[model samples]
Target: MLPPFTEETARLKVQLAEDAWNSKDPARVALAYAEDSEWRNRDVFLDGRDEIVGFLTGKWERELGYRLLKELWAYTGDRIAVRFEYEYHDTEGQWFRAYGNENWEFDERGLMRRRYAGINELPITADERRVAV
Candidate 1:
């Protein structure tokens, strides 16, 4: 039987996600998902860890200088919700701050089996620049 989802587990999941983003390694981040995981990131839909890794690699490549910060919004049972804000400069030197929310469903083993994310980008002005923590 699967263990109950507690506050500790929810907090740990958020921390793990943050750590994975900080690592900036697509392969390593993909390991947090199940083998057949599915994701809807922005407008892209992907299945399986390999596809997930590939998607992330491509994203990081195009969205150069990427940095992210994720915060736990809520969690219940095996599902977790997060709100994230990230800043990245495109290959052409356009800077943006992307704000998004993600809903995640995890399997019994704590591997994310499904993810749905929605994001919107806003151009940042030079005077509005703020460092990510």
Candidate 2:
């Protein structure tokens, strides 16, 4: 589970992350990252777990009803690539489906040390919802 991952463990890691994020608890989700983790989520940059926590708190607050699904695209050594999608609605009741890809680098302890993500969002009607938390 640490690194140089087997296929089973890599998929497990992705599932675990999806579960944690779907919980929408910033502090809880931040535990999966290294203390000094670095992240480039979309356009914002974050350093350390504190920033991670802060960023997620804001994200969940704004992205109401956030539900996420993550799939392992590839894995080798300490690096893993993932594809993910999430659905959320804004305060104005506009629903959006977001698609993204992430590249993760983990430390020996299995904590994520670096995360890079590229995301795109499309507005959809409520009836178009395909995911639920």
Candidate 3:
């Protein structure tokens, strides 16, 4: 079983998630989830690994030069909450700083079964960009 998390394990899980997302590989990130994982990212909803892959593919494609940082906010048993920030530029080179929180539920094997993310974006100049890879 993967959850029933302790402070040490929860912190490690958060860092592992951060590393996976930073890899920018859709498949790699998707592997962290269960086969039928469900997600609500902003206004979009997705189910299953294939959908997760597609979603992340499109996200990284448009976000452009994405970099992220995630911090463990809280955890108990099978659920965890995280706070994060990411910096990205659009195709037109307009930079943005995205701030977000995610709530995650993991199955017995430690793969996330559910994810709910809420985010807000603020336009910033490249000079104001803060997140470093």
Identify the candidate with maximal TM-score: 2
Q: Write the residue-wise lDDT of candidate 1 on 66-95 in tens digits.
A: 888888998889898999988888877888
Candidate 2: TM-score? 0.98
Worst 10-residue stretch by lDDT in candidate 2? 124-133
lDDT of 2 by residue, 36-131 (tens): 999999999999999999999999999999999999999999999999999999999999999999999999999999999999999999999999
Off by over 4 Å in 3: none
When 1 and 2 are scored with TM-score, the better candidate is 2
Q: Which residue pairs does candidate 1 place in steric collision?
A: none
Count clashing residue pairs per candidate. Answer: 0, 0, 0
Candidate 1 deviation (Cα RMSD)? 1.9
Q: How many angstroms is residue 100 displaced in model 1 relative to the true structure, after the best TM-score fit?
A: 0.9
lDDT of candidate 3 over 4-116, digit per residue (tens): 99989999999999999999999999999999999999999999999999999999999998999999999999999999999999999999999999999999999999999
TM-score of each: 0.92, 0.98, 0.97
lDDT of 2 at 92: 99
